[model samples]
Target: MSANIENFPGTPLSQADFDEGKILTTHWKPKLEYGWDAGVAISRYLAELKNGRLIGIKCNRCRRTVVPPRVVCEWCWEPMEAWVYLEDTGTVNTFSICYIRWDATRAKEPQIPAVIEIDGASRGAGILHLLDEVNADDVTIGMKVQAVWKPAEERSGSITDIKYFRPT
Candidate 1:
């Protein structure tokens, strides 16, 4: 194979003055296992998802519903003991159209990620998920949105299992 320098024309690229280029192994690590169970709350959340329910736990003391199902309330610092069905509707608390790799596993294309305050939950209590079915130009700070869940059988015990949210 030959090296074509069209993109970086006239730029000094290290070709080693050789017939062809070679790939390098800069670093390597052994595959390993690492995980947290997230326990009953998340487990129950997954189960609820199977039933087409968006479940968040509410703090009985503060009455604030926390998405991602925390076992404790972020406000009153009390134990969260009630399961609440989020309305699947929400207002965008704030958002950004990220034009970079959101994570090591995300697609090369940029994604619109937002913190959404789902209905029936207190302000500032929200979930982080991707926004779809809307253009980056259309996304705004106060936009209303709703969840679009994957088929029940396709849901995993993870956020992506919800697919993405879109304008309501």
Candidate 2:
């Protein structure tokens, strides 16, 4: 939708007034949703995490397991048919050391968000997480890591189920 002042209701607001509205909305709530497919997978994953397991679904056609599980094969476009247990340990596919914190949800310390290629999964298939217990200078592609989970009482159905990753 267009945000032009001329299309706004009633009198046109000045640039300063429009800027004021933008500033106010800067902290507005983010959009949230729970579609049918996502809900089922999330419920299952969370239950598995509570039992100290990392769960993912495997595509019947491609024989590739996907973490945070997908309802279908991303590569072959076929329904994922089986459940698989993934090793928390994986090689870092790509990573970035951030000197600046982009979101308040992260730790006060600088974080390195990485795309980790989990063991036994298809090439390039990966999960993103913050890398911990290492200095920024030591961070490198292909570094192995293991998931550090949150306390059982603090577990949730989201990525936050794992607190972070540490050197393996």
- On lDDT, the candidate that comes out on top is 1
TM-score of each: 0.75, 0.71
In model 1, what lDDT does residue 51 have?
A: 72
lDDT of 1 by residue, 105-131 (tens): 656667888999888877788888989
Model number with the top TM-score: 1
Q: Which stretches of candidate 2 lie over 4 Å from their true place?
A: 1-37, 103-108
Q: Rate the local accuracy (lDDT) of all candidates.
A: 0.80, 0.79
Ten residues in sequence with the least summed lDDT for candidate 1: 17-26
Clashes of each: 0, 0
User: Per-residue alpha-carbon lDDT of model 2 for 1-168, expressed as tens digits?
Assistant: 575555666755578876767434345687888566556676787788776678888888777788878677768988776988888788988888776655535456677899988886767789888898889889889888899988877776567877888888
lDDT of 1: 0.80
State residue 106's C-alpha deviation in candidate 2, in Å.
12
